[model samples]
Each structure stands twice: as C-alpha cells, then as structure tokens.
Target: MGMIVPSLAHWLEASELLNGKGMFMTGTDTNVGKTWVGKQLIHTLRVLGREVIPRKPVESGWNADIQQTDAWQLANAAGLELDNSICPYRFSAAISPPRAAHLVGKHLTLQTLAATCPTRWDKRQFLYVEGAGGFYSPIADDGLNADLAQILGLPVVLVAENKLGCINHVLLAAEAIQQRRVPFAGVILNNRQSLPESMDNLNDLRAYLTVPVVTFPAT
Candidate 1:
C-alpha cells in the first residue's frame, strides 16, 4: 500500500488518539529495528506537541547500563524524562524476553507489565508500548506479545524487517493477532535487506502479506 507520509510523520499524526487510547508497536522478529520504529513514534508525538512516554514491556540483555534499553532510545528520541520504572522489567541475556529474563533470574508477567504501564488520560501525555521481540515473542513462560497488546486494547503496528522471510513472518504474526482478537493498525517494513537474493523477494512480499507494507529503506 502507498504511504500517506514518512513513518515517523504518520506516527506524529496518530499521537492525537493517545489522549484516550494507546498504541502497541510489535515486530515480525527481533533486531528488526523495532526500537527504532517505536522511538520514531514517540518522537513524532513529542514533535506534534504531545507528552509521550515510550515503554518496552519486557527487555533482555544490556550492552552497558541494564536500564538503557529500547525504552531509553524512545525517551531519548522523544526528549522525555522518564523514570526507570516507566519500563518495569529489565532482563539480561539479549535473547527472547522470557528466556533472557530466566537467565537473569527475573520472571515477568504480562498482567503486571500491563498494569504497571502509565495509565490515566491526564497522567501521561501519551503511552507508546513497545513489545519485546515480535508479536509471538514470549514475554512470560506462555504469554506472547499479542497477549500484552490485547490487555492494552491498543491498535497494533507490526514492524517487518526481513525482506525474504518477511511475508511468512508477517502472516504468522497476523494470525497471532487475530487469535488474540487485537486490532492491527498496519505493518511497517524496515527496508534493510539489500542482498540481491533478498531484494529479489521484496516484490513477492509486497504482494503476499494481507496488510499494508510500509518500507523503511536504509538511508
């Protein structure tokens, strides 16, 4: 589908709904620029004059500061001063949330994560919930990101970063979303796959996924 505006700019416009609603940003897989996309969403909202707080329900592994995860990126991009508890669960291991949390001797619950989010229309400028890993990524022993989104009752914006395997991953994620009865806003394709073989499959993906594919090519 054709884009209405740059992804970030479009998210800036979507921030208007956050006064009474929230937005869930999930991805097709890990390392798919999910952090980048979530940050842009918050940054756009802040630029649009909204006080937006970005969050990652569950994070795993840290390069240096354990607290400086995806949530930090969003806060930095949005220029918002958010306390560490704004993103409650910080797990180490750099793996899927549940596994990473287990490795770090921390167990996270979706209900707690959902409940801990900064709620209330007046309390927060806007809430941007970024999922750990992908829609089907495990947040708890059995809970997935879709479960988190369902509890939040927010429209999902899926981020697909792979070029070749994206269509399959996207369709799988859509199925998960449907199973959880969550509303999907659309899918954004992080256009970083440039291998000739991978590039050859881009058009194929554009034709297959049942949702709009918003591509963010490498600059």
Candidate 2:
C-alpha cells in the first residue's frame, strides 16, 4: 500500500531532504524510551553505512555528563563524534523544559532552537531530531514539543509506550499529528508486551488508524 499515514507525518517532502540529511524523532510522553529506540535505529542505520546525526532539540535533566543522556547514546550508537551541539537546550530539572528552565532562572525560546537547523550535518547523513516529552508536552512557556517538530519540517516518528491506557494517549497524539499537519511517521509500540491486550489493542489501532504501526519486540 501507499505510505502508512503515521509514516507520512514528519516525512521529508523531498527524498533529497533526507537522502543523506536527517530525520526528526519525537515521542508520546516523558520516559517513554525515545532515546532507547532512537539509539537502536541510529546504530542500525549507521551499520548500513549511512551518516546519521541524532539531536535532541531540547533536553532536560542533564547531569553534566555527556555520556549519560539520550543524545549521547545516539551519537555513540551512530558511531559519530560527540559534541554539545547535538542537543541545544539542556535543562537542570527533570521536568518539562518550560518548567525546568523556570526553576533554573532562564526562558527557553523556540527561536534559539530554530536557528540550529541550518547547519550542515553531512552531505548524505541522516539527521534524527529527538524531542523532549510528548506532543503536547510543554517546551517554552507558551508552547510544547509539537511546536518544535512543526518548526523542523521533518516527518516525525512517535514512540508510543504501550503502558496501560495507551490507546487513548496514542490516538490523541495521532489526532494532534493530523491537526498540526506535521508529517506523520507511524507509531512504535514501545514495550509491546507490557499491555495485557497489546495484540488486541494493536489490531484495534490498525483497523481505525490510517497509518501503519510496528511494535518492536525485545532483543
């Protein structure tokens, strides 16, 4: 069939956009393992001999250790050299960037983040932009991570953790994707086995959703 609707979200309009450029990655909610799944995809893509650049547009809860965060893991996973530029905004609190920055005495701005996109990552490299928190998650004082994804113009892959009541959460996110008109790149049913009726739920999702979904099994 044609591209699954979810796969279409955050998708590059021009293959030329990501022929060797980058992809933007986002998630459903906080601590949903965006980094874990992103690390594997970056590593796998890198092994296939493509240049992959992973970035967290906004990150919070940094420990002053480069190797500790998700961005670092993606850098290492893709076998690329690490640098602070990979993730632009680092917040101290373990909360949303807007709230976290408030606790740290600074305002996080979308303009600051939008400025980082023009830099050349690699000629044929993949740029994977990871967002902090879910679609509706607060980014700036007035915006959320979904806004960040919209600014990037890259199709987005949403990692929907399959915990209890995920159908509501994931479907709500899908609606937001549609409402925003951001490229919809399908959902990764993270922790596929966690839900008691995961298979049943997934079938329900597939039946109603216009996008294609893939549930990742454990390694």
Best by TM-score: 2
Query: lDDT score of model 2?
Result: 0.70
Per-residue alpha-carbon lDDT of candidate 1 for residues 1-219, written as tens digits (9 for 90 to 100):
122336556533443343436678888878899887676556556655667767766677755763366767776766756566666677657787778877857777778888767667654477778888878878877688878888889878888875666778888887788778877666767766466642544456557655455556433
lDDT of 2 by residue, 1-219 (tens): 122232222222222232445656677788888888777666555544567767776678986887887767877887767676777778778888888888878887776776656666556677788888888888777677778778877777778777667788888888998899887766777774555543556667788787666665431
For each candidate, the alpha-carbon lDDT, in order, equals 0.69, 0.70
TM-score of 2: 0.82
Candidate 1 TM-score, C-alpha based: 0.80
Error of 2 at 148 (Å): 1.2
Regions more than 4 Å wrong, model 2: 1-21, 119-123, 192-199
Best by lDDT: 2
